[model samples]
Target chain A: MPTISFDGQEITFEPGQTIIEAAMASDLYIPHLCWHPDFPPHGSCKLCSVKVNGRICSACTFPAAEGQEVVSSSEEVRQLRLRLTQMLFVEGNHFCPSCEKSGQCELQAMGYYLGMTDNHYPHFFPVRDIDASHPHVLLDRDRCIFCELCVRASRADGKNVFELAGRGIHTRLVVDSPSGKLGDSNLDVNDRAAHICPVGAIVVKETAFRIPIGQRKYDRRTIAEVSVAEEAPLLRKRYEQKED
Target chain B: MSKKKIRIATTSLAGCFGCHMSFMDIDERLLDLAEIADFDRSPLSDIKHCEQCDIGIVEGGVCNAENVEVLREFRNHCKILVAIGACAINGGIPALRNRCDLGDCLEEAFLTGIGVTDPKVPGDPELPLLLDKVHPVHEVVKIDYSLPGCPPSADTIWAALTALIEGNAPQLPYELIHYD
Candidate 1:
């Protein structure tokens, strides 16, 4: 067993367990965006970054070893997370006003919680198109954070509908075939990508305001808080039971 | 009282009280703040009416008529105006509404929606209306300092106040530096 301490709380884990899994197994919260238990760790959002022996590493994917000392809430950790979240904000056109996902939006909540006040960086405001082709869903390219959660969900879940085209800063989510609008792409709204979007980039069409602002899923809890509970075995088992 | 001792007023306009609360969240250190500064007009203090203060901290956003009046008065009275919080510094969460047309929102919220009140909504008001866009404080007024954050962490707040108390420009911790 490998042991680790996050901000002084000790947790032991089996070999190969990620710091995120170990932290959650012992009830320690580590904030994250692109890492999910069911899905492999994609360190894009970088919110789950932590300090390991005074060095920054993404906890969602970092391997925990014997006597590994982790610091989750240190100033260093916060600084990194803040920059990452800010990058996500400026990287997209996240005007919350016209967005149907305002309260439910994770990017807004994280930005606030982490104290991102100014977009110190220039707003790229890259020209992105809104795909309203999907009758049941809307894809606003400007709002996408490129977490690849959607891509992972589609591929892992065997749908093969969503895929990343291009590379690096120019990367984007695109339909699997014909390059037609998502509505014409034969994609389903119930796909995993639709459910895991951290922002309003992908939203269900008809139910935009079906749930009021204050009542959306992640509005009440921090991203760390929600993911920790979801990672628990008992909770996962219970969720699976409900689905079955 | 004694030659106005650099009158400083703190007020919150369209934002969560957290920034103001964080100001008070300084806890016992507030006693130190009280000693050096004269509280003229602050939501936390009794003195209303901006009586030509030296510094004004405007929090939140300009969503209503009252906000416009308060912000304008602060700009008029204070020698230095600081935009605090993401809401005041930028449009913040409230600015999210800026994406939608105010006229349409007014109709949806006050007229056709479930919370319909006076069937006839006022087409105009006494206060100056916000522009089609909700802008950051610097966009509206000359901001002396911008302490950003949904509500910046308490440590950042402490550092800012300490610097102000010491008559030195506050240095935001390097690790705390984040551009929204």
Candidate 2:
């Protein structure tokens, strides 16, 4: 194990741990969109951009090295993080009130965490499709942030049912079927990829409002609160295995 | 003598009046709000015309010509106009109709819906004409502020109104600033 410096604090990490993983292992929360624990880092969303050795890089993909200095909470980095989150908001039709995932969406909670009061960027309002072809899943194309979480999850889980198609600005989520529909795809309700969507883009149909507002995730406590709550156990284990 | 309480006006356009209900959710706090502000041209007050109020709180989207007219009148009268709730800030649920053709939507509801008997589109000169698309209030007129919630919690309404009454920007806590 080697130690890396994150935001002026020393943190220990195993070999080959990304800065984000190391930070997470030590209970440090970094704002992220595409990075998920269940899948490999795709680094699509740059919301986790951090200053590594004074050079900006995505913490989720950048490897943590011994004595490496990582900065995530500086004034410049904070502004960039805010702008990135705002861009995501404007890019999607994230009418939080109308969405079933409102109270629980990590993206929305990120907006709160970053203190984004207004979408400084212009809203794209792209008229995307809401695919209700699946009996269980609702595919709201408008809410898709293009994080490729579904793609990564399906690939990792060996379902290989979802993929991000198109090129550049024309990019969009696609189902792996001739009919181009979720029902035609082999996706089952039990797949980890089925539950990997951070936003309301993909969700279980008929389960809307199952968890009432104010009683939902990120409602009682912020995403940061939940992130830190995962840190205590790791800290205790490290203390027990501490080497003189 | 102290200046008159901040005159406040409110109205519902194409919404379900849920935001107004949330406003009423203030419960006993409504009494406190009354001390610092007076309702004018609001459903609660039942006033017919807006009287150059200090603040105007609008809920819902602009779905018809009548909504546009009412929204313009509010802008003409109030010193500040705030779009409250999701419908006011954005079209919310009603804007889902933007996906459908207006004529086809009308036909589906009146001409070809289930359990329809002798159905007519209810065309009348007195009836407000539908706009081609449902629009958030900002699309029609300027809004001084926006309170983002489905039917913003009662606490949110109270906090926003109190801030407006105190001549400051309405800053809500993250817990209160939900879209749904």
Candidate 3:
């Protein structure tokens, strides 16, 4: 058993476990954009940057090694994560006040966790079309951060309904269909990728703002804190009842 | 050589005084600050305007007419200009309206909505022209440093001040890496 400490709390892992797997088994969550248990880790979003023995590395891809002191809370590491967050915030039209996602949004929670009080960068103001194509969902292109979690989930889960187009900053997630809408695509409502988005960029239609403020996931604590507590038996039972 | 007594000035522009209050929250660190830096024309201290200082901390967004003049004066006077807090950094809450049409907001807030009075826009007055959008300090003038928080925690202010005293780039706190 090799020992690794996450934020100074030591945990032992089997020799071949990735940080995400070890963290999930032990209840620590490394905030990720392109990682899922069932699907292969994409490591595209880079939101999960953590310090491994003083070097910043993505936790989702990093193998947990013996005697490694991983720090997710160092000043330099947190700022780097925040810059990614800021890029995402300004990259999209994140009007928290008007958004139906408001309090329930993971993007908002992460922004709060990262201490993003202002949109410091230039506003892209990229015009985006709203796709009301799905019967139960409203797709807003302006809100997408291009994390590609949706594409992986759809592909891995045998649906193969979603994909990404373009490259670099212009890259975007696309639904596979003639109309290219979720309604037109062969996606089932039960796809895990639809629910696993860290932000409400790809949300279930018409359920935006359904949960009132002070009731969203990670609303009270950082995702790291929430994930740590979620591993406990008592909290796990409580969390299941609230899971969407 | 003895520690050079750095001169400093502070100005509050078109924003709530929260950013200025953040500086005051430095508590006992002000005692150490007095030893290393001399207050030149800070609103919180005896000074009223710039008297040639080493650093200037500008608080608030550029919203009204007087803000531009004051900001320019501070930039011209201080050797280093730092934008303090969310308002100075990114126009804060006021900037939310930057997305909304200004004419619509003015009509709703002043003329047709609650507390209605058709007020004439002042022309030959001391009032500054209102820009269509709120702007961060850096957009108007060059900024040497930016301390961003809603009102950056007192710890951040202290760290930034101490870094300036030591002539080093202050590192951000681990708890606050993403400031807008």
Candidate 4:
């Protein structure tokens, strides 16, 4: 077993593991939005940025090296995360008070974790369309963070139902169907992509606000606490099975 | 000798007044707050215009020309201005109209809306003109602090007010901070 210094704490990691993966295995959480354990790292969100030997790198894609010093919670890294979160808020129509994902949203939780009290930048307030064509799932593009979790999940499921279209600032999520609608696509309500959105973008119809406010996930506890408690065991089990 | 009391003023524009209600939710703590602070131009005092004050707490977004004027007045008069609740921080619900054309919105509400008696948009000169878009307070003027929530919990308001009165930056715990 090789060891790395993560924020001055010694943690052991197995070879071929990314810094975020190793951190997860050790019950540590590096704040992230796009990186999911089930999918390959996308490094799109950049929320998991950490300093590796004084150089900033996306922890989800950066390989953990032996004896490397990883600074994840420094003032510089925290400020970077704060600005990134603020950018995400201003870049989208993230009216959290009216959003169904207010409490459970990973982005909102990340804002709370970063102590973000205001939208530091002027909002873009981009005009976006909502795809309620699907009977079961609704695609509210207004809330999409372009994390591409759904894109990867649908691909992993061999559906390829979602894709990112357009260029920088104009980038958007589009359905892979003839009519360009979620209803016309092959995405069933049970698809991993349907429920994989970290935000309220692709929510199952008739399930909005099912969990009352203040009782939803990330409400009572911070994202760091909830993420570590729920993900650490799953990662540990997966690694254990891999060894077997 | 008595210490000089901190003068605080508050106002609501384009909001439901829920944030002001939450401020009142501080309940008996208002007694404690009154001991150290004097209400200047608040809903409680019924003062129409803001006077020179130590703190100005604004609740709502800039939806119409009047909101911009009121916010600017607070910014000019107060030593520190705090934007309270989601509306003031990011144009909470009223901003939903940002995606739609203002003419469409007004026509829908005044002309095409269901069960309308007289379909006519009001054109009174006294009515404040609507802006093209709803904007958070900071977009119009500098805000020294922001306490975010739908109507930030009563405890959150209390904590922030006390901290500001004491000349200390607010340090809200995890449980106290929420967007909804």
lDDT of each: 0.72, 0.84, 0.73, 0.93
Q: List chain B TM-scores, each candidate.
A: 0.81, 0.97, 0.87, 0.98
DockQ of every candidate: 0.12, 0.34, 0.13, 0.85
RMSD of each: 8.9, 3.9, 7.5, 1.2
Q: For model 1, how big is the CA root-mean-square deviation?
A: 8.9
B98-141: candidate 2 lDDT, tens digit per residue:
76889989998998999888988879899999998887787678
Off by over 4 Å in 4: none
Native interface contact recovery, all models: 0.13, 0.33, 0.13, 0.82
Clashes of 3: 6
TM-score of chain B of 2: 0.97
Judge candidate 3 at residue A218 and give its lDDT.
52
Query: Which pairs of residues have clashing backbones in candidate 2?
Result: none
Docking quality band of candidate 2, CAPRI definitions? acceptable
> Which is the winner by DockQ between candidate 1 and candidate 2?
2
- lDDT per residue as tens, model 2, A93-122: 888876789878989898878766555554
When 3 and 4 are scored with TM-score, the better candidate is 4
Look at candidate 2 and tell me the lDDT of residue B113.
95
Residue B9's lDDT within candidate 3 is 93
Query: Compared with the true structure, what per-residue lDDT tens digits does model 4 show for residues B45-144?
Result: 9998988999999999999999989999999999999999999999989988999999999999999999877899999999999999999999989999
Give the Å error, residue A240, model 3. 17
In model 3, what lDDT does residue A166 have?
85
